[model samples]
Target chain A: MVCIRFLKALQSVLDSRITVLYETHKGLGARFVDFAGWRMPVLYSGVVEEHMAVREACGIFDVSHMGEIEVSGPGAEAAVQYIASNDIERIVDGQCQYTLVCNDTGGVIDDTIVYRRSADNFLFCTNAINTDSVFCWLLEKLHGREGVEVIDRSGEYAQIAIQGPASLDIFKIAFGIDTEEIRPFRFIETTVAGSLAIVSKTGYTGEQGLEIYLAPASAPAAWDALMAAGAGHGIKPIGLGARDTLRLEMGYPLYGYEITEEFGPIEAGLKRFVALEKGGFIGQKAMVERAEGAPKSVLVGLRMEGSGVPRTGYELFSGDKAAGNVTSGTHSPALKYGVAMAYVAPEFKEPGTRLNMQIRKRSVECTVVAIPFYRREKK
Target chain B: MEFPEDLKYSKEHEWVRLEGDTAVIGITDYAQDSLGDVVYVELPAEGDAVTRGETFGVVESVKAVSDLYSPVSGSVVEMNDAVVDGPEAINEDPYTEAWMLKIELDNIEELEELLSADEYQQFIEEEK
Candidate 1:
């Protein structure tokens, strides 16, 4: 309900432009689906084909859809630390940390990335739907904190992700920078194709890639620059369909689908983001207590023992009892098997523990498996 | 999108290629395209009875799974093992090799209630 209210408020304030791919999507026979209220490309050639392309070579994505916020002035780090689950103090400048913003009750507001640009400046990268919520939350948190400024810069920046093994080479030529020096979770404010861009060595695809954040008007130019530089490397433009599969293959959680407000960060297998030792965050005490106790359910990976593929919202069973339900599942092109992530009863979370997933009304056999069903070879 | 002129079509995008009392059932190219990607297909076992307009199987995509309904009352004579093993065949070539099952019909008259290629195309256009 907060998201709905926030979206209504945002509509009154922001004017978002749909990208050119919206038209190109229809041309490529893409089944356009509404994602976070934007008409997005779900599939182009196909999800499976696009998913395989990212695993094999390079798959470009118009992630311009993700929300961007800039926090400047002194006390920006404290403002983020007081609101986010991860310890902001631990993160060094030019580095990014995956963190969760939580409600007072320990429920997830959203999972976000905090990019520490400097002691006084920071950028919070978040999901498209939760931009308003994150902005409001930070604005309220920093109300009396002098010298701190929270600005919703979502309308200004466009995000593009070139994901796969060939991404580093693609970044090197497009930006004329030695991208090999950039480590994971690190970023550099550099010019690419004559446009100011923040190139970050981070992605959800479990591949070596850079997510370029630049001006919205310059996005098409940046995309063209990448495609031109990467044409020889077998890079192809990918849609959201491939992005989901690639992330699912790596066991990366997607907001609204895998993680939701009804669940806390610890239960969602994101305990790493919960800074229990840190003092006085919105959900700190509740999360700390939960960490010491047992979770009602723990997220685990499941594979169908037979042939059928498990899907989101499909019930997971232990004997005749409804133990859990699937959150994300896919037919991994690399594994050549059906893989899924589900929050089952704690007893069922052990690796190799046998379980059942209701495909239709039938109880199909399954087993808990290790996550990242397909891990690409390290670069 | 291929909608065979000789076949009977359902609003749900199923197609029935009839030859006397026998019928070959599969999803149409329109169905495959709408489904986005065919990751898995669950078909009824041979000898299983299917009622007209009842769900006979399911086709799963990365985003969603849709129930496949039978257009005619029939007994499953043979399930397409190839489509089961390689569900992507329906995405690659939906019209021919991706047929779901071969059925022995109980009521051939049910085919009369379904749409032809032109009618199905019109039905799809109206749906959009």
Candidate 2:
């Protein structure tokens, strides 16, 4: 009886409302477009200038729109293990792990960050659009369990991602927290601008940086503190324009655009998260049956040999026959070439496999490359 | 922002300079700004016949790659080698040194039908 009511409440929350992050810049001349119900910043200045800022110097990204959730109580770890594809048994306090929450059919519900705050408490940082759906899914799963508590902390918190090579120094000076001791995927709770913040050594840009989480009311102060400290070091408050290109360069998948419900985690090259060894979880039986082999349209990186760019929805052809379509593409600022990720027939997923993109109905020759068209230099 | 009075413009943000039987063609400043960071250009082969309002090639930027349409019916006589080699010239200077192609105008009357510099500026403003 309680499970049924809990499921109803969870469904109501999912259907309630969509939150948007609007930046009123006083008509600085930006072409605003609606993305996943959020009016995100595509480009404030220019895509190239902003892209260069992150690669060369540093850039501050307003990532407050990302969803934040908290799980606590005795059954927190059990609930998380059942909900997530990766085993959470090894997660220690003050560390984070990137994993996915999948549907029963092994389809991705959302890719998120699991931050274990303590033995019985953790946080799930999810993509903005998947907030309500993920929360509902977690609740629905937890409704059948006993002594599990899940809270939607998204409204209470705001996140700012300071990314790029210069991020560590800027973060250290801004928050007066020594970042040298903080390793990748580790976090430390500290005060920034007289407000409590949890600084995590993690970012989507594949650089040395910290994602500072603070109270929603303290956002303005936190933003100001970081900008002021990073002003001399060439840290600019970048928009979603550079953020997409930076992640694209690193070949990170964006939900709905790259990874979708129609494509399972195995086809998307994310089988590392699904642990068959773990006793049981949602999607376990189906994943186990398909583990032997499943004919999949595999995801791969596409690079143009000629003077053209392969964009999303552009048909990928293997000698006049349609094989797949591009999921994401951009002129990589670091490589200075057009790069894209796409799903193609498994037979043609190997590197150096020649393919063609239908640009304006004409096939432009391209080659399949390994994932992550660009990688950060080892320090 | 500098739209020379002698040039004729298209609503798609292409500019043409009528030179008797031939017209030089390129994109306007507004087009470059909207596209942002011209990285590569695909120009049609010389002597390829093209019609007005038909896509001839593509111009790639960091954000998107859009089709470049022909503003006048003609055969492609020559393409700007400078802009092809260094595409940033299109964003740096779209009018003089960054002209895209030279077309032997099939009908000179097509130029008279295009928007004048003043009209083009007004069209851009209306778009905004």
lDDT: worst 10-residue window of model 2 chain A: A17-26
* Residue ranges of candidate 1 with Cα displaced over 4 Å: A1-17, A20-29
Model 1 chain A poorest ten-residue lDDT run: A12-21
lDDT, candidate 2, A1-379, per-residue tens: 3565466456545553222223332233445545554555678788878777888778887787788989999888888888887888867899998888888887788999999998889899999878877888888888867878989998887788888888888877887778878999999888876678888999988777889888877777777777788999988777777888899988889998778877767777778877778967887777766676755688999988876767889888887677898998987888887899999988889999999888775678889999889887776
The list of candidate 2 runs beyond 4 A from truth reads A1-31, A320-322
Q: B40-123, model 1: which lDDT tens digit per residue?
A: 888899999998889998898776789988888879999999999999999888878998888898877878899989999999
Residue pairs clashing in model 1 are: none
Q: CA shift at A57, candidate 2, in angstroms? A: 1.8
Candidate 1 local lDDT, A1-379, one digit each (tens): 4675666667644653465445544555666666675667777777777887788778888877788888888888878888889998987988999999898878887888989999999899999878878888887767888888988888888788888888888877776788888899999988876678898999989888889888877777777778788889988778887788788888998888767877788888888888888878898888887788888888888877887777788998888888898998877767877889998889888898988888876888899988877877765
Using TM-score, give the best candidate's number.
1
Interface C-alpha RMSD after superposing true interface residues, each candidate, one decimal: 1.4, 1.4
Error of 1 at A280 (Å): 2.5
